[model samples]
Target chain A: MDMQSVITAAIEAVAAEQGKTLRPLTDDLVLLESGLDSLCFAILVTRLEDEVGFDPFTLSDDVYFPVTLGDFIRFYDDAARSQAAPTLAA
Target chain B: MQHAAKPLRRWLLEAERGRGRALLAPGTRLTLDALADTTGLGALRGALADRNVLVSTGSQLAAAEALVELDGLARRIVLAPPDLKPTDIPAVMAGAGIDAVLCDGDHPGFGPDVLIAVPGPRVPLPDAAAAEVRDTEWVLLTSGTTGLPKMVAHSRAGLIGAIDPSALAPVWGTFYDIRRYGGLQILLRALIGGGSMVLSQAGEPMADHMARLAAAGVTHLSGTPSHWRRALMTPETASIDPRVVRLSGEIADQAVLDSLRRAFPGVAVGHAYASTEAGVGFEVTDGREGFPAALLDADGAVAMKVEDGSLRIRSTRTASRYVGGTARALADRDGFVDTDDLVERRGDRMHFVGRRSGVINVGGLKVHPEEVEAVINRHAGVRMSLVKAKSNPITGAIVVADVVIERTFPDTDAARAQAGLKAEILDLCRATLPAHKVPVLLRFADALAVTPAGKLARHNA
Candidate 1:
């Protein structure tokens, strides 16, 4: 599956686990407002790790600054693409 | 063999030279000199002289040395607990009359007048004559679980004197060589004693902390009961040297102490009774269940007083005031700070009856959640437990326990195990606790919510 499709699936899984439905995780929907507390956000990161093969949660930087779902997805996509570029080049 | 200067800075400098040991926390290991440099005590002297400085930092060493540096500069320092929320910051600032704030990067925003920033390398200010301040000038905030937080003010000399390092000297040789008061106290005492401070950035992983302790050859280690409990449950902790384990924070129960003794065999297990308001009160090295009432005054309170079974303490070591409120007298008419903990004395030892707010009135008989939770926690399958008083029309308030089971149990069959475990816990409570104190309601939760400070959120339980 494409990165966007994987991101959508992960978001849906998180929403399901939280017993709620998301109105499509657009770039404008704030993660905090979407009911992703620190713990849930951690679980989401773990799920994304499984699907995307890379965990983006690093303590040295602020990964939670992106407010909306689209913003988070874009950030993840860029990170995944960059992470994969070296391997593809090899 | 001997150091002449008695200043806190001098003590830390001495420790750095003598120990040559590093205090390790995750990716950081700070030497005494590095810590001293970061505080910039020399420059802070001018900015903080005769001013109240509020320190907000997660690094125990930084917080501890900052206290010492502020003391050296004659600045009144208020050490805030790690779990202090941003919402309560304004009130604490106003209550303590905090003139400035010193924080690390993790700390949030502060007011413009608030001198909020990280401590750079070295003491920047020039040395000047010590600033004058009143005796009863330091303030600490109450945990505020039962009601609104209050400021407990104390005199600098008096507060420092309350530490009673001699009481800790016995077990110090056995545990990690680092001073114990959680991390903050460890750093403060290490700096004061001129001993090396160790840091462990072991997130929630018990194995990581054990590895750090083993790698550092840490002979003195202190932590909250919860931290110790987590360590005990972890398999890796058994293989690590137990001779250096020193437990503090909450009251040490017999089961927990016995468990530690069994695990560490030769290690000395101990306990301490202290609060933000009372500073350090009493120490128990024999692994006693409760603190001795004699350690307290006539009120049967430890470190303070017993107000209708609620512990209260008055000390020169108390905080100046709440951060946002006017300076109110922490002492009663007779001059003692109340700690608000309930207690029952037996001979020389006193047992904590649990917090007054945690007491549940079941059919007119009082029940402490801790008493019930202790029974629940002792269960083989349970990892942690929180017991709270839930309203019941017939009983007024009944004891309800929420338990978090260890992951070793199968997830699919967790409900069945939880039911069996709940029965086992109920049976244990019935055997040990009084009929009224026995928990009537049992809940098996995936996890218990904890505060930033690693304390269970008992208020919401």
Candidate 2:
């Protein structure tokens, strides 16, 4: 699946968990401003781990914190790329 | 039948005359004299001479000293935990009508007139002040809610009514901090029985506290089911050997009781049912999850009945009222207080069915989240589980769960292993519970959030 669709599905999952319906999102949307506080962020990350794979934050070798929803998608994209690179080369 | 009641001070003084030790600290044993000589006793008694005091302290030793000294001086005492946010203190102080604080800081906005600095020279209460402590209320704050702390008032007699004057004086240890209701009961039970207690510090690490209890040779230990679960997860718990193990403040499932038996061989495990609003209700000594159904009509001191799945209790030991707040009768005109704790009759016993308001309704069928959580928690890989309700169009609501995995695996294959565990959990639930009760969605939380009172935070959404 493409990164954009993957990220949108994860966000939708979190919103459903909170009993909320989210408006369509854009790349420039700040994650902290998405009404997801520290508590909701924790649940969101948990859901992301299940739908996608491991938490991108824990999988990456270097420290990378995402600020906007676009950055969050890019972070996951980079981690997925790195994971695939090892298999592609073999 | 017209006997006069003795003051709280007199009863404590009589207990102090016994040869048993009063407190067991890390390296020191405290008799009643040593307890009286704890720092700032004189200053506390002096400040509490004529007015009510808000005793908010982080130190358990200081709290014990303040409680005894306040009672000795016939001073009205309200216990407000110091860990409360600065914003919540003023309203609590106002509600309790507190005139002074025994802590060192003016953080509660209680100026010089209110703050009583400890570590000052000792000044004992004058003999006249100890004449009689009557018509005084001991106010305790509830910990579960987010709004203003609910202030509960209990008469001195009512507080100690259920404490049997047994000659056995076993050293005790408790997981509850003394500020909360569950902790206060253990403290009073030990003191009134002329026994020593290893007080658990508020911010101390559980492993460290368990080590201290081991060092103090804690023979009697009581805690909530959550506390026991956490303790059993660590190796430090193996150092302590308790003869009398009591569980309260939450439901004691057979899993926890069986584990306790395995951990401490030959230990007598008992679970008691009590709350801050409702005094000591009843105890089940027969290693079971619920009380015997026969207790509803048993000629016990406390009368109990299950009405509409909620336990109603009527006893002389029930608390007086909420001071300065509307007094909601815990019982009906017949003196039965609706405890709000839901229970279901299972054959010969009544099993706890969680809180009434917390139940998850799935397609008009009632599902107790605690019951589902209990079943999930029994799984070996599950550390803790929170069963919640999710809105669905077809079925009014659907059951879901968030669990913390206790076992760790390689980082490369963690998700796959977690998926397997989730499958196992789902299979177990399907086999044990009804179709409607099984969780449709099971997610993994790094750690489940617990309430300040050490209970699982349910239905956060």
Backbone N/Cα/C clashes per model: 64, 4
DockQ of each: 0.01, 0.03
Collision count of model 1 = 64
Global Cα RMSD, each model:
15.0, 9.5
Write one digit per residue (lDDT tens) for candidate 2, span B1-461. 11115544455556546465766554555565444434355534565665677887767766776676676454578887645777877777777777877764334457555655454544544453453455556888876556677778887777778877575878889988777788887777776676778987756778998998988788989888888877887789999999899998888887788788888888899999998888889888888888999998988789898887799888878777777655455457887778889988899999997987788877678898889988998897886788998754335567789987776778999889988998899889978997678776798887776665667766534
Comparing to the true complex, what docking class would candidate 2 get?
incorrect
> For all candidates listed, what's the TM-score of chain B alone?
0.80, 0.90
Q: Which candidate leads the pack in lDDT?
A: 2
Q: Using TM-score as the measure, which candidate wins?
A: 2
The 10 consecutive residues of candidate 2 chain B with the worst lDDT sum are B1-10
Mind giving the per-residue lDDT tens digits that candidate 1 earns over B315-422?
A: 545443444555466557766666667887678766786876667776677887776777777776666788887654334555667777766567899678767877
* TM-scores of the candidates in the order shown: 0.69, 0.79
lDDT at B148 for candidate 1?
46
TM-score of 2: 0.79
